[model samples]
Target: MSNRVLKILVPIISIILGLFVGAIVMWMSGYDAINGYIALWHGIFGSSYSIGETIRQISPYILAGLAVAFAFRTGLFNIGVEGQLIVGWFAAAYVGMAFELPAFIHLPLALLAAAAAGALWGLIPGILKATLRVHEVIVTIMMNYIALHTVNALITTVSDGSYKIDRIQKTASLRSEFLSNLTDFSTLHYGILIALLMVVVMWFILEKTRTGYELKAVGFNDHASQYAGMNVNKNIVLSMVISGAFAGLGGAMEALGTFGNISKMGGFTGIGFDGIAVALLGANTPLGVIFGATLFGSLKYGANNMPNAAGVPVEIVSIVIALIIFFVASGYIIRVLLNRMNKKKEAK
Candidate 1:
């Protein structure tokens, strides 16, 4: 089969395999797998409120997936997206609370603060990799802890004594005023629109811009890029900065649109970590990320209903997601088996 066909078939097959495995797990645990699945579907697609919640969940995933996907394209493993997200959340929240500007200025300013904070967080590992010849993975991992503790301390000591940031200014919050009728007061906001716009922007930058070419070239081969007069170091740093910006924006969207505040003790939310899965599942493409985010969002929203309806554990959803990722990543084994079966048939 052609690579393109394989690409299309692999994820579909993996999803089927994952569902089968999940069913087996449910059966072993004394639950009716079919009922569990039905509950999941009902939660995700049954009502307008469910659908809106799914979309809200997907908004952050879209941006976080883009962050990881963009870094992957540059051959960088950005494990620090979690840290960047925390920094962005705090920055946006702080800015939102500190300012008293009009809605237009406050909202943009908060978002910009988030992007800047995330970019700065990303820059640390980028600089370490560029100047000190350190591996980005190592630096980013360390930075995650730094970000977590720093944010925790800031929230605990700097502002309100609580573990959460103050509620954002009304003007800074992103509301679904226009879509209120459709969403039924779900916290689904304009962040979804922003995420979609960023996807288009990312696609355009990666496919049609010179900087994108340079970043990809460096990722493919730093030595070759250097020989070809590409600034490999600069590209590496720039790629991380851009990746962090995406993640930061994701944090901003979540803080202002959904949470309306930043948590202190929780530090980096798992959204950044989940982004890695989303990026891999999407094959690191803009369109792929959107689909991956949608699937994840649906599963997450659906899982909430399973516990109430079918006596199934919500954690099963994570297991199913893990199974899907595992199967997809190991698709070559499936391909080899299929090829061998085909060869035997031809010989017969």
Candidate 2:
């Protein structure tokens, strides 16, 4: 099989294995696995509301997935996406609330603010990695904490000690009444459009651009890229900035579309962390990330129905997701099996 075929088959096989194992677990626990899955399907697609909400949940996952996938392609492990996202959320929310302008101007301005904030946050670690030989993983991990506390303080200061900020004005909102009515009044927004656009942007950048070539080359080997006259350090920093911008756009989805406001976070949102699984399941490819995000989004949203509809705990869904991740992580085994099968076929 071609490498492309292998890439597609791996995730498909992983998802099937995960579901199969989950069914076994459900049967062992005295639940009807078939009923559980039936309910899951209903929860994801039974109504217009469900479909809208599922897509709504998927919007941020797409951007977050892009953030991690971009960095991975550029030889960086950006663990700070959560932090960058939080700051972006704040920046977007502040922009939306602090100013009033035409919708065309206000909305794009908020998005740009969010992206810039995230880029700045990412820049710190990128510069450190490029100039000081510091590990991005360590710096990004610590930066998550810094982003959390700092954003919380900023929220308090902005809200005069309140825990939440004001809702965004109409001009800055991504909500569409027409879309809401079409989806039976779900919180659907234009964020999915933005998410889809970024997917294309990522694809174009990595697949068609010279800058992307340098970035990927640097990621493959800094010494080789440097010997070939590429600016390794610049590429590294540029990669992080772009990755951070994607993550920031993710925050904008929440700020302008889902919630329309920023609130104090008592703990991590888990969106960025989930992006890790998304990137892994996607095989770190742009189009692959959308498929991965859809699976995750549908599963997560549908899991809510298991308890009432099938008498199964929602935690089972989590277990299934974990299983899928495990299989994806062990993709080398799958590749080996495929190779053996190909060899046996040749012998015949």
TM-score of each: 0.95, 0.98
Best candidate, lDDT-wise? 2
Clashing pairs in 2: none
Stretches of model 1 off by over 4 angstroms after superposition: 338-348
User: What value of lDDT does candidate 2 attain over all alpha carbons?
Assistant: 0.94
Give the residue spans of candidate 2 off by over 4 A.
Answer: none
Q: What is the C-alpha RMSD of each candidate to the true structure, in Å?
A: 1.7, 1.0
Task: Put down candidate 1 lDDT per residue, 1-348, tens digits, no spaces.
Answer: 566766677777888999999999999989999999999999999888888889999988999999999999998999988889888988888888878999999999999999999999999999999999899999998998999998888887756587676889999998767665687767788899999999998999899999999999999999999999999999999999999999999989888898888776544578899889888888899998998899888998899999998999999988999999999899898778767776798899
Instruction: For model 1, name the residue pairs that clash.
Output: none
lDDT of 2 by residue, 1-348 (tens): 899999999999999999999999999999999999999999999999999999999998999999999999999999989988888899999999999999999999999999999999899999999999999999999999999999999999999999998999889999999889999999999999999999999999999999999999999999999999999999999999999999999999999999999999999988888888999999999999999989998999999988999999999999999999999998999999998999899999
Question: Against the correct fold, how does model 2 do in TM-score?
Answer: 0.98
